[model samples]
Structure formats: structure tokens, C-alpha cells
Target: MEILLAIIVGVLYTAGVYMLLRRSIVKFIIGIIFMSNATNLLVFLSAGLVQGNPAFVNATTVDTSHLADPTPQALVLTAIVIGLGMVVFILALKYKYFEITGTDDLDQLKQTDEHS
Candidate 1:
């Protein structure tokens, strides 16, 4: 199960990187979102997944032996939210660029002295 998860994660990372190399601004934004998700997954995996423990303390128990590590989960959760915000911001930038320049291709953004 762990190996399968790792392989899936590797594939996601590769795909994200490959997509990010494209010239289209929209694709680039999407690729960045994918890459962020991949990074979050890698961080989560590195923290060691618990088999069955939840991240809450038991009613009477005080020791921290049986509960899952909460830090990684919290970190990943925050990262995901931040990633979503970044995706939204990047998409807004893309839309603004499209509206102002009429193109989404990075190579086509050459500034002209007359068009300025």
C-alpha cells in the first residue's frame, strides 16, 4: 500500500513538473496547483501515516502514544488551503493578462514601443 502510494505520488510530481514546463499561462497555473498538491502529499507521506489512529486524545488517556501525529496533518491542511488561494490568484492573473493583452501565451507577450 505504501509503495503504491509512493508510486502514485511520484507520477503526480512528474506530471506536474511536465505540465509546468508548458508555455500557456493557464496550463502553467494549473501545473503549479498540481505541483503544490504533490508537494503537500510528499510532506504528508514523509510524516509517516498512522494505520488507524485519529489525531484526538482519548477521554481518560493522557499519554501521546496511540494518537496520530497532528502536525503533518495540520501542515498539509494549511498547505492545501494556501495552494487553493495561490491557484485562484494565479488564475486571476491569467485572466487579467488575457483581458489586457488578448493572449495567454508567454512567448507572445513581447512589448512593442507603439502598443505601449
Candidate 2:
């Protein structure tokens, strides 16, 4: 399962970078999403997968060796929220840019920069 997940993470990272290289703003946003998800998965994988192990401990004397680490989970959750906010903000910027420039192609933006 870890091997499969590692392969998936590699594929996602590749796709994200490919999308990032595209000239369209939409593709760029997708790349960002892909990268974010891949990063979260990578973090989770690093923490090790413990089956049937809960993060909570009911007793102080109980064996805690097999319990799942909560730090990675919390980090992933925070990253998700941050990634969502970034995506939303980027979309809003795209909308306003499209409204004024009538184009989503980043190459077209180069012309505007030259004019200024």
C-alpha cells in the first residue's frame, strides 16, 4: 500500500508540474491543487500507516507504541484549509483578470506588461 501510494504521489507531482507549465490560468490553478494534495499524501506516508490504531489514548499506563501519530493528520488538515483559501483567491483574481482583459492565456499577459 505504501509503494502504491508513493507511486501515486510521484504521478501527481509530475502531473502538477506539467499543468503548471501550461499557459492557461485554469491549468495553473489545477497544478496548484494537485501539488497541494500530493504534498498532503506525502506527509501522511512519511508518518507511517498504522491499521486499527487510533490517535487517542484512553489510559496513561496503556501501551502507546502502536498509536497513530496525530501531528501529520493535523498538518494535513491545516494545509487543506490553506490550499482551499489559496485556490479561491486565485480564482477570484482570474475572474477579475478575465473581466478586464477578456483572456485567460498567460502569454497574452506579456503584451500587457510590455505596454506598461
Candidate 3:
């Protein structure tokens, strides 16, 4: 199962990089999102999947035995939030591009050649 997860994560990262190289703003944004998810998954896998007790302070010391690392979960949450912010910024940039130029194509954004 762990190996499978690793494979899936690797695939996602590869796809993300390929898409990110494209000139389209939307595809780049999606690629960033996929990359973030893939990274988060890798962190989760590395943290190890334990099924003991929760890492709460209120609970008695039942036995940390094998608790899934909470650090990765917290990190992933922050990463997801950051990814959302990036997406919003990319979308806003795309919107501004369309409003100013009336087109979404990257090749059409040549302002140096066109007399504005």
C-alpha cells in the first residue's frame, strides 16, 4: 500500500511539472495545486500510518505505541492554504489579463508588437 501511494504521488508530481511548463495560466495553476497535493501525500506517507490513540493532551497515556505524526498533518494544512492563495492570485492575474487584453491566450499577450 505504501509503495502504491508513493507511485501515485510520483505520477502526480511528474504530471504537474509537465503542465506547469505550459504557457496557459489555468494549466499552471492546476499544476501547482496537483504538486501541492502530491507533496502533502508524500509527507503523510513518510510520517507513517499508525493506529494507536489520538495525540491529545487531555487523554491519558494509553500508549503512543504507533501514532501517526501530527506534524505532517499540520504542515499539509498550511500547504493547502498556501496553495489556495496561489490559485486565487493566478486566477486574479488571468482575470486582469483578460480585462486588459480581452483574451486568455499567452501567445496573444504580445504588447510589444501590437500598437496599444
Candidate 4:
């Protein structure tokens, strides 16, 4: 299972990077989404996939021998939320860019290169 997931992550990264290098704004947005998802999966997998109970201490004595770590889960969850926000902001930027220039092709952005 871990091997399969690793392979999937690799594929996701490759696709994301390929899309990111394209000349279309939509493809760039998709690439960002794929890359973010791949990153999140990588982080989650790095935490190990041992089958155990939740990290909750019960009663007086604290026995954490077979408990699962919660930090990675929390981190991944937070990252997902942040990634969603970032994607939304990027989409809004894309919309504004299109509205202003009426073009989604990144190559057309060369018009602004003269100013810089």
C-alpha cells in the first residue's frame, strides 16, 4: 500500500509540474492543486501507517505504547484548509486577469514585459 501511494505521489508531482509549465492559466491552476495534494499526501505518508488506536490518554496512567501520532494528521488537515484558500485566491486572480486582459494564455502576458 505504501509503495502504491508513493508511486501515486510521484505521478501526481510529475503531472503537476507538467501542467505548471504549460502556457495556459487554467492548467497552471490545476497544477497548483495537484502539487498541493501531492505535498499533503507526502506529509501524511511520512508519519508512518501503523495500525493503532488514537492518541488519547485514558484514566490515571498514560499508556502511549500503541497510540497513533496526532501531529501529522493535524498538520495535514491544516495544510488542506490553507491550500483550499490559496487555490481560491489564485482562481480569483485568474478571473481578474482574464477580465482585465481577456486572455488566459500566459504567452500573451509578454505585452507587460515592455514595462519591466
Top TM-score: which candidate number? 2
lDDT by residue (23-89, candidate 2, tens digit) is 9999999998999899989998888878778798776748888888889889889988998998999
- In model 2, which runs have C-alpha deviations exceeding 4 angstroms? 111-116
Clashing pairs in 4: none
- Cα-based lDDT at residue 47, candidate 3: 77
Off by over 4 Å in 1: 110-116
- Model 3 RMSD in Å is 3.3
Candidate 1 residue lDDT tens string, 40-90: 988888877787778777587687686778898989999999989988888
lDDT of each: 0.82, 0.90, 0.79, 0.91
Q: What is the C-alpha RMSD of each candidate to the true structure, in Å?
A: 3.0, 1.8, 3.3, 2.0
Predict model 1's lDDT versus the native: 0.82
lDDT of 4 by residue, 7-76 (tens): 9999999999999999999999999999999999999889776565877786964767767778888999
For each of the candidates, give the backbone clash count: 0, 0, 0, 0
Report the error of model 1 at residue 5, Å: 2.0
- Candidate 4 residue-wise lDDT at 76: 95
Q: Which window of ten consecutive residues has the lowest lDDT sum in model 2? A: 107-116
Compared with the true structure, the alpha-carbon lDDT of candidate 4 equals 0.91
Candidate 4 lDDT trough over 10 residues, lowest sum: 60-69
Most accurate candidate by lDDT: 4
Candidate 1 collision pairs:
none
